[model samples]
Target: MKNIILSATLLAMSAGAALADAHSVVRMGTEGAYPPYNFINDDGEVDGFERVLGDELCARAELTCEWVLNDWDSIIPNLTSGNYDTIIAGMSITDERDEVIDFTQNYIPPASSLFVALSEDADLEGGVIAAQTNTIQAGYIAETGATLLEFATPDETVAAVRNGEADAVFADGDFLLPIANEDADLMVVGDPVQLGGGVGMGLRETDTELREAFNAAIQSMKDDGTLNALIIEWFGEEAATF
Candidate 1:
């Protein structure tokens, strides 16, 4: 009789441990200040298009995900170090980036672009455009006989241009649109620069299973009305397509 009681207690403990391990949280990291993608709202909630998208992906994969906010440049390193399992920031899939991190299939298609002030002093008269460091947008604008100054992130570039520290800023069109719309002092102009690849959800090279699950979940959302409805609600019309 004692043996039977001991066995039952062991089984209960094992089951409890298994339940805890199964629900182990998956961490998501992002640049919390990048507007329209991931940003800290006045209420201190990390909310944006990417936030909603990441939550849906975690739900579809049957995982619990915790959102972590960090600066842009350090995001990938943190992921590689296992601080997080994934990144849902507005990260593009370029071969240069793929050399470092493994990306699930392109999740969002961004139109690369340049935006300058409406000031008569605005010199998009076909010169150099500045963009974030190592971004495809910088490379694209560099081809236009415009010298490209690579800043650390969009916020820096925007600040530079707004304060006359730089002539124009180049980046993802949709992201720039929101900022430009909010600040009358700035305006987005000129044709968008196109890059071939699509933006992707990032994961470490050892996380193929997680990547596959995320891709599958994204496809499922796309097939149903969930993805479309969310896109419209956030963008007020349609999500940008590549």
Candidate 2:
């Protein structure tokens, strides 16, 4: 989904100079809230599938890297402003977003978006649906007859449904399936919505060199089957891969 304000900034930066170098200690940005993708562990360190994948990527590309946490809403803005060198967040590659920032070839393939509710019969078509602000799911809901409620974080979107603030929460199936399986009160309510091209790393349009480096790294993982293994490890065997 696109935000007009950020789109303006992105367009402004698209023609600017590249901010990364081969020897630079690349700063990797993430939300540190969405689990299995990226999150802060008990040790207060950035930990998750992205963490491991990012580390390997850095090694393969022979670049030093450090993690930077940013709120999801401002992740792109911060990157454009040079707060980080790249976004290793589980961001989907979409035409609307490609207008703002460049994306590497997808590390995670296009996957289903599932609707989760407290009851099996919950109204999914016309009911109020919760989704994280600025996400594809939120954009999809806005086009439907259903009322869309936006939250700042993925957890908050799920909380909205649990607390009856919304009839259902829609998000990546990988993110919601674990929650649904662990909670007896929650269940998937409808067929999965296929959204976005796939999940990939976001980089400034000017950072072509850096993007190419990471792209090569990702391709290596894919060829060796490490990428698929990581997908299965974090999201189960059913999760889509490159």
In TM-score terms, which candidate is top? 2
lDDT per residue for candidate 2 within 1-242, as digits (tens), equals 23543443343233222323443688999999999999999999999999999998877766778999999999999999999988988898899999989999999999999999999888888999999998999999999999999999999999998899999999999899999999899999889889999999999999887887777777767776789999999999788877
Q: What is the per-residue lDDT of model 1 for residues 1-242, given as tens digits with 9 covering 90 to 100?
A: 55554453444344334434544887888888777878888999899988998887776666678998767778888889988878888888888778889997766755556566656456664654668876677777666766777787788888888777778887877678778888888887766677747778888898766676676666666555576677667665746642
Cα RMSD to the true fold for all candidates: 9.3, 8.4
Looking at candidate 1, what is the lDDT of residue 38? 81
Deviation in Å, model 2, residue 98 alpha carbon: 0.4
Task: Give the Cα lDDT of each candidate.
Answer: 0.73, 0.87
Q: What is the model-wide C-alpha lDDT for candidate 1? A: 0.73
Model 1 misplaced stretches (Cα beyond 4 Å): 1-23, 125-128, 142-144
- Count residue pairs with overlapping backbones in model 1: 3
